[model samples]
Structure formats: structure tokens, C-alpha cells
Target: MKNLAWLSLGLMIGQFAYADPIENGISFTSGDWEIVCDNTRTCRAAGYQNEDDGTQQPVSVLLTRAAGKNQAVVGQIRLGATDTDPTDTEVQMKINGQNFGKVSISKDGDFLGHLSSAQVEGILSSVKKTSLIDFIGKQQKWRVSDKGVAAVLLKMDDVQGRINTTGAIVKKGALTEANVLPALPKPLITTVKVKSSPVQWNSTQLSQLRAALKATFKSDDDACSMLTDPQEGASEISITRLNDQKLLTSALCWRAAYNEGYGYWVIDAKAPYHPVLVTTDASDYQEGKITSAQKGRGVGDCWSSESWAWDGKQFIHTGASTTGECKAVAAGGTWNLPTFVSTVR
Candidate 1:
């Protein structure tokens, strides 16, 4: 974290457009340029030119009067080289010269992290360069290059060039088809909080279980897409066929053990017996992992969710280890479900 001077040269330029008091001038000895606005609210500076391709690019820095006397410094801050490219650009925000976090546009032009923010000031800095060009391009090169704001801004002209070459198609001049596929189904959570011993469910838990089953069924084809196979698959709920046609409607319910984006399937099932819980892991051929969790209370099971990750081998259940375990095997991501409705006649 480089501590910027309260009166950096770049801050002046940002203030130039907002407040009208900015004045541009040359640095006498540093040979760097500066912009000062409103006498005190904003200030900016550029670094001495570097000789790369005989191009002396400016490294712009800016500072603004922040919430208190503490000033907010922002603009392009160079970190180092990428695997191939020599320079990587990051949008830096600081308070009173101390570093806050940054959002770096990798050498590959990928925006990494709106990362951790120490305060609101950091958030503001992120918004400033959400779509900056040079800050994004320099990292794509296979060698060292200047990653200054001016350089990036210059490169943005290339992006504009591409857009112009493609030529924008007016919607009114084009015939577009409507989106017919349904939206992704919403997640359903169980409401029962069953505790130790004789467990039972309430309307909330039953409703949640119904919704969860619906989502699971709907997710069948979608989940199957995650598998290696190309065909539709079957999924099932397991319960013992206890009595001879003794009307049994057991719903599955269990607390999730992992989080989202991990390999897990959230299920809501329950049986007539006490201590009924359901938890499972899911994966597809494409998007690897997804996990789901649910917990029950004393005779009142309330399912909650947690997440976990997978490494193509086994599921890394996040949080801590649990006694409850359920698995949702994926075949092209479609559930290879076991028998669902098995009862004695």
C-alpha cells in the first residue's frame, strides 16, 4: 500500500469535471504534471515518464477530501507483471494515503475482486474504474508494458474501434425471438426446527418439503446436464415399506451441511418415525459442485443450509463435519434416483 500525498496530481483532474476550481500546472523539478481543484478538496499528479518504446507514459494519482479531513486517493496503481505481461493494472483506493483494497484487471483482461473493503471509501474507488480499458489491456501482453491510466485510456480507443467495426444493429431493424425457456426455479427451505427425541413437523416444514421436492423435480433435467450422459435421469426418495398398504406419505427433511456453488443437493423429506433427516451432495458434468443443509429442533426439525466444495473426487463438506449424510449421485447431472414410492399393498 503506497501512501499517497494528500495533494497528488491525479486527484486534481477528477475534481476538474465535478468542481470548477482545478488548475493544471507543471512540476518544476519532478517534471511531473499536476492538477489542483477548489484550493483544498482535490489534487492530482502524474509520475515522471518512463522510457519504454521511448514513450514516457504518465502514472496518474488523485486525492479528494473525504468524509473528514482524511482524503480519498484513487486511480490506476501498478502492482507487477503477469505470467506473460510485465505490468498488471489495479484500480486503487486509499484513505489518507493508506491503502484500501483494489480491483485488478488481470493480464488476461479478467476483472478480479471487488475484493475486501475496509470502508465505504474503498467501494467508491471500485465503481470508478469498473469498465476502464488500459487498466485492463496491458496485462494481456507477453512482456513488460506501462500500465498507467493514460495508457489504458489510449488502449480503450481500440475497444471502441472493434465496436465500430462490428457496427451496432438497431433493435427496430432486427427481428429477435422471445425467450421461451422458463426462468430458473427459486430455492425452497424447510421451516421445521425439530430438536432431540420424538420429532414431528409443522405446516412450515411440510410446505418447505413440498417446495423443495418441486424444485428438485424441476431441476432434474437441469441437473442431468451436469452429468456425462445425454439422456434424462431418474431421482428418488427412500423410505422403508413398513405396513401393508397402511397409507404412508413420508417426506424427507434434513439440515444442509454445505453452502452453494459447492456440490450439494438440498432435500426436504421426513418419515413417520422420529429423527428423520435428509442431506445430499450433487454434481454435474459441467458446473461441478452444489451442496445443501438442513437441521431439526427438539421434536421440531427446522432445516437450514450450508455449502461445500468438491475436487472431482469427494465433496468437501464446509462448516464442520456432521452425523447426517445423504448423497445425490449425478449422471449427466440428472439424479440417478432410487425407488421413490415403495409401500406394502
Candidate 2:
């Protein structure tokens, strides 16, 4: 199984200074507006053209909205490494009816939008600044959506609103809908269970072994750093027998994948015996490749990292995991799953 990390609302969204006027290429609905944020941390309004529903445009904008909130917008967008020039690369934004906007992000990679100032004041008119609680008491439902940019969606959440206020923001009376970007789907990591010898392992030791397994899987894939999202990648594992003896010791192990081909590792030292470093089918990794020096450290076909000796017991180390929303490439359908790594303990 893969280690998929789900980033809760608290970790995904952040606040930054607003910069640059709306660019010309980006067009918004007469009443609807859209913004594109690229990987470089730049946000900008993308230019667009609207036609009747029957129009022949093959590429349509996809949009996600916050629940109860009106007119969703793309909150944060990212650019590809090759896509250095925002204007040249076409970033798509969609929510509700689709085609919210299409345009290149600015050179600096940032964009911002307000409802023409007039719209903001109009929405605020109903609220009283003194007793703000009563002024905007209506609930806002928000959903997040965007095109698949590969690794860009990692660490992003859709349902969570972006705000620094201590309390939730509510709308009272008939307030025009607010448009926020759709949240990315959470990624799924691999799930595994490690088995150690019952005689040699205690509950506390088992828990410690489990933790060690989790760490091994994380270090191998770079999933911790790359943001493992199993939904977008593939993963699988195998168990290898180490020693040949009358009372044999065995380890239940897991090796999974995320990203293009990043793999995760999970292991359990079921017995006191440690397995000898052997050849792995994996490439870019091998036996005895461990960075930390100790006895029995090695690498092989395994790609991510290597195994380590933890607490007098030998354990494997892999990579970290991450979560984000993504659309399936073939269907263009929405997908979301929380943390990918299932409990191994």
C-alpha cells in the first residue's frame, strides 16, 4: 500500500500580500470572476470569453465552490517547471458552470481579485461592524476544484475556508455568493501491517517497531517531502525471508509507491534476528545504501532510501507522505482521499 497524506484545512491555505492588477488575457463572467495562481506563488485573473451553452469550445473551465458561498474562484494555482512564462502557459480555472477563466499567470506568478470594490461594500452593507457576529450569520458552503497539474495539488484543501479570524464568517440576509477556489482532492498513501515474532515482542515493543516501520516507509519514497498521493500514483510491496535456521525469524514488510514512481517502506522486526542485506528488484536503490552507519545497513532495488537499526532492533526508513485533491486524467472526474497510509500498528 502507498502512504497518502491528507493535509487538513489548517495546513493548506496561507495569506500573502495582494499584488498586480488583473491581467488582460484573463476574462471573467459579466457577473462571475476567476483567478489563476501559479507554482511560483503568483495569483492573477485569467482572461476568458463566454458564449451560449452550445458553444464549440472543447476545453471548458472546471470550478469548485465553498458550500453556501456563491461564485467560487481558484484560490491558489501553481505553474510547471517548464512553464516559466505565465502568459505563455494557459492555466484553466473552473467552478459551477465551468470556464471561470483561462489565461497565463503574470511574470511574477501572483494574482488577486475583488468584486470591483463596489461589490465588496455592497456585501458588507448588511453587516454591522460593532456586532459582526449577527451581521454575517449565514453559513457559507465552499468547494475546491482545478485542472490536474501533477504534484501542484499537493498540500491543498478545498472545504477549508481561507481566513485568519478566530470564528467562522457568516452571511446574514440575502448576500451575493462569494467565489473561492475549489480545494484539491486529498492523496492516499499505502497501508501495511508488519508482523514480528510474538515471543520476542511486547506491546510497547510492538508499537515501537510499528513506528519504526512507518519511518522506514516514509524515508524510502520521499513521500514525506514529495507529498505522497496514492490516488495519482501506483504502489505495491513484497516480503523477503532473511535467515535459514530451525527457529526462523521473519518480518512482514510493505513497499508502495506515490508520485511518478516514488515508493514507501514499512517493516516489523517480528523476531530478534535481522535479515541480511540482499539484492532488490528495485533500481536507483540497493542494499547497504543507508546514510546512517551501523550494522546491517544496506540498499538495493529499493529506490527511495534504506533500512536503519532503531532501538537495538533493525527497521526500514522510507519517505514522507502528503495529501491533495486531483482529477482523474482519463475521466476528468473529481477525486479526494484522506491520508494514504493506513495504520500498520
lDDT (CA) for every model shown?
0.27, 0.26
The Cα error of candidate 2 at residue 50, in Å, is 18
Model 1: per-residue Cα lDDT at residue 267: 25
- Please provide, for model 2 over 91-183, each residue's C-alpha lDDT reduced to its tens digit, 9 standing for 90 to 100: 433233333444343454332122223322322232222111101101211122222211122211122232321212221233233433332
**Which tens-of-lDDT digit does each residue in 1-345 have in candidate 1?**
122522342353333334232121111112222222221112232222233434222222222221112123343332223123234455544443445554554455322223332433342333223222122233232111222433222112121121122221101113222321111221222222112122245766654543444444344343322221224232223222212221112232221333222122322234322221122332211122233432333321123343333332232333221211111111111111111111111
Best model per lDDT: 1
Query: Where in model 2 is the C-alpha error above 4 Å?
Result: 1-75, 79-312, 316-318, 326-345
In terms of TM-score, the best-performing candidate is 2
Q: RMSD of each candidate? A: 22.0, 18.8
Regions of model 1 farther than 4 Å from truth: 1-76, 80-224, 227-263, 269-345
Question: Whole-model lDDT for model 2 versus the true structure?
Answer: 0.26
Candidate 2 versus truth, CA RMSD in Å, comes to 18.8
